[model samples]
Target: MTSPLYGQMMEVPLLASSLLSHASRHFGDIEIVSRRIEGDIHRYTYRDCEKRAKQLAQALIALGVEQGERIGTLAWNGYRHLECYYGVPGMGAVCHTINPRLFPDQIAFIIDHANDSYVFFDMTFWQLVENIAPLCPNVKGWIALGDEGCMAQFRADMSVPVQSYETLIGAQDGDFEWPELDERQAPILCYTSGTTGNPKGALYSHRSTVLHAYAAALPDAMSASSSDAILPVVPMFHVNAWGIPHAAPLAGAKLVLPGKDLDGKSLYDLMEAEGVTFSAGVPTVWLGLLSYMKSEGVRFSTLKRTVIGGSACPPAMLRMFEDEYGVDVIHAWGMTEMSPLGPLARLNHRQKQRPLEDQRRSLEKQGHTLFGVDMKVVGEDGRDLPWDGKSFGNLHVRGHCVIDRYFRREELPLVDGWFPTGDVATIDADGFMQITDRSKDVIKSGGEWISSIDLENIAVSHPQVAEAVCIACAHPKWTERPLIVAVLKPGATVTREELLAHFQGKVAKWWIPDDVVFATELPHTATGKLQKVRLREAYRDYVLPGAVESDA
Candidate 1:
């Protein structure tokens, strides 16, 4: 005979709509700000956002959007887009955010693959939508996120029946009740920018998204709170703007959305104007902001912390933010498949007690896991590697937010219940995870592996170097040797020998790049990660000097 369990609570489903409801009820008066692409500022409150979201939901329902159907958004970070984040999922329809930065062909492919019933886009992407609309036959209608005049202009230019987002929502009242939805039902779909082939969709469940938001708002995670004015320089299309869209509302934080104006001056001006206390973006973005601020001798007044991801944040960047600007740079790591947030680099109390230099070194790592995610490194033979801070292996993660399978694909990407992250990393005894290299980008020289990330990081730390990437070049003796492709700061000059000399004491002699190639710019992905695949292709036939072909 089994005993009955006591203290059981109500079995309410963890729907995404609840987040909006909670924000409206508790943080109704908090401001949600947006710097629009039209060179203007749009301001509203949580109450307004929630009401508009409900109106949008009613609009979608009137448009005949069925439950669990996919609705696509091709827009920037703004209040309207934020409304859809709740509106689409809140009504049990999946929100598929298409990255307009992707190639037109890729965009068409994604729309067709998702079979989106309707596509909502901004005025800035009018030409893009017009170009790709014919390619995506599944898209039944189009909604331009603008006023009636803007919609009329779009309609005049296109053959499709385009509706104005404002008109549709304004026609509806906000009294519609949200339908009950299973927590495990898919509510959001984001595609990975695949290095090869087409992008694959990562359909996220309501439960996973809500859990990720909770974890992201924790003290060790993004540390989102009501007192902070949050600025997400990261685009909303990129991993839900690193999950800040959800986490900000959940924490009742004031959100400052920089819509398509990520330039240094634009970002700096907006941060100052909004009194931004915390922000999140990629290293390339911060590099520009730092350069602009340094050149102007300007400093942050209210900005305190920033979360850097999309790629590894260099140690020099971490230091510059901390030492010069008095800002904390939190290095983070995640992928599209993991609701895009996992480990965040925040030092514990004991770790903070160490020497500043030592603490900075630890902070340079990707970070330790958040509460919901579990990580481990495994060797080639599938055995778990030791967490001694030196053993590098393929990183594997399992968590409530981790994806078990891709959207519309039945194949499972897991190995023994763990999702392989394709990242070569080391987990130290203290739980700090450092990414040595991408598994495909690791440079092998003379039967030993060299970290391209390390080489790139060290090169960028030089005062004159603006950006850097390390790629493997063919060598006769070593088979493959590291080559540095560097972009210099404007008007700055440095010799290849001088650049190589800068790495002399920081890394092993063999790990240093054998040669340097100067360039005005380097290619990067839409999400701001270094496009190493393109770099590898560009330097594929390059031969290292003083090296002979191996006969064996």
Candidate 2:
């Protein structure tokens, strides 16, 4: 007989709603910590957060905000943002997250496109609010998510009615019921990063969000628990901070907020002050923290686990945290469409006997797909490749949480019930998946596909390199060539010849970078992933040997 499916699909109560009641029921005293702009730390319990969410919901309704209307927030990862995550949705309204790092035009477009009726913003986004308010004519009011004393600095706004978030919460009732949801109805709408084209909204339904959150808190995913003092350094505007806010509360994890300031110093201070045990953010955020620790002679005394996603975590960065800092860095991989849950690097019991170095090397792969997620690799012929690690193919995924289509832009390209992730990868016999390249980032040299990711990883492993970027440049003999950009560590120097020599014995000599360009820093995406497109555009006109210079 076929093995029965192990995972169960059950209708649990609304996570936030249940958690608040539970906090009041059992864990009422657990603290939710946040460092606010008032220069004082704010501490509350889940019971308080639940009551405040209800109050916010009541306040929104009293303000003539109706269910199904869009509510937008331009704030940081904090307690207030967490309130909006539940309050708006519980009241049957959709929460649209606007990326603060997006260009002014894009931000305006997303707000207008979502038809947001009200905006909750942070004090730091005052100038951004002023510039974009006129463009978003549908927004009837703006609430600054600040304490009473800190609201004065943000009161100088334009045409919209500016209100204090504290005042609204203080004046409302905290006894509203969350309407029963269709589960398929849109609850959250987040836009794609728009690196290639116009940003399209990936609207998530209540069911998808809830399912993804369940997966996120699983043993292999985030493995969050009530004991985990979780700090999501990822921005709330980006894929629901990789769904951490939703999952953490569902698991009753104590929430720690770093607020609007995410610099290394501020983050480290919060982690230490809050006694955060588990955290999740991109590699760049942790990279800064690692550098800060090195410079200031600090260490992560309280932090025990970290989740690195939004981009591939360099093995060196992972090693630093796991080996040196004594914090486990779980390499995660996902995208906006997957509700950001695809794979996680959880070492099984079998791998525990391996050497630390070997374990680290295995963890660098994206790890096994979660229970609800199913993954496959497809070659150019659209045939599924074996999960044998040796075969590199385009990665395709289909699952419960994976988005079926884009909002307002149906006809999304789909094949055989799977969504093309645009990622190239290799799957080992044991089910560990390693991303080789982005479909667009792969370089074709002399009709052979070269993974720039592999090339850059090798280059950065050199002692002198601090950062690296690999892009395809014009080649006279090969049509397209791989160009490596290297950023040196402080007080370190190496020429192109010296770096190429280091990689000579490791990779094929022909696969080595033909020309190495040194730089002070590498540009990164809003989510902290290396922006290879920017690197390509920045050096588009580079002249290569025996090649003509042409703008890419």
Q: Candidate 1: lDDT over CA atoms?
A: 0.91
**Alpha-carbon TM-score of each model against the true structure:** 0.98, 0.94
Best by lDDT: 1
Candidate 2 residue spans exceeding 4 A from truth: 1-16, 19-24, 157-159, 355-357, 546-552
lDDT score for candidate 2 against the true structure: 0.83
Best by TM-score: 1
Report the C-alpha lDDT of model 1 over 139-185, residue by residue, as the tens digit.
Answer: 98889888887566556777666788999899999997878899999
Model 1: residues with Cα > 4 Å off, grouped in runs = 1-3, 152-155, 549-552
* lDDT minimum window of 10 residues, candidate 1: 543-552
RMSD of each: 1.6, 3.6
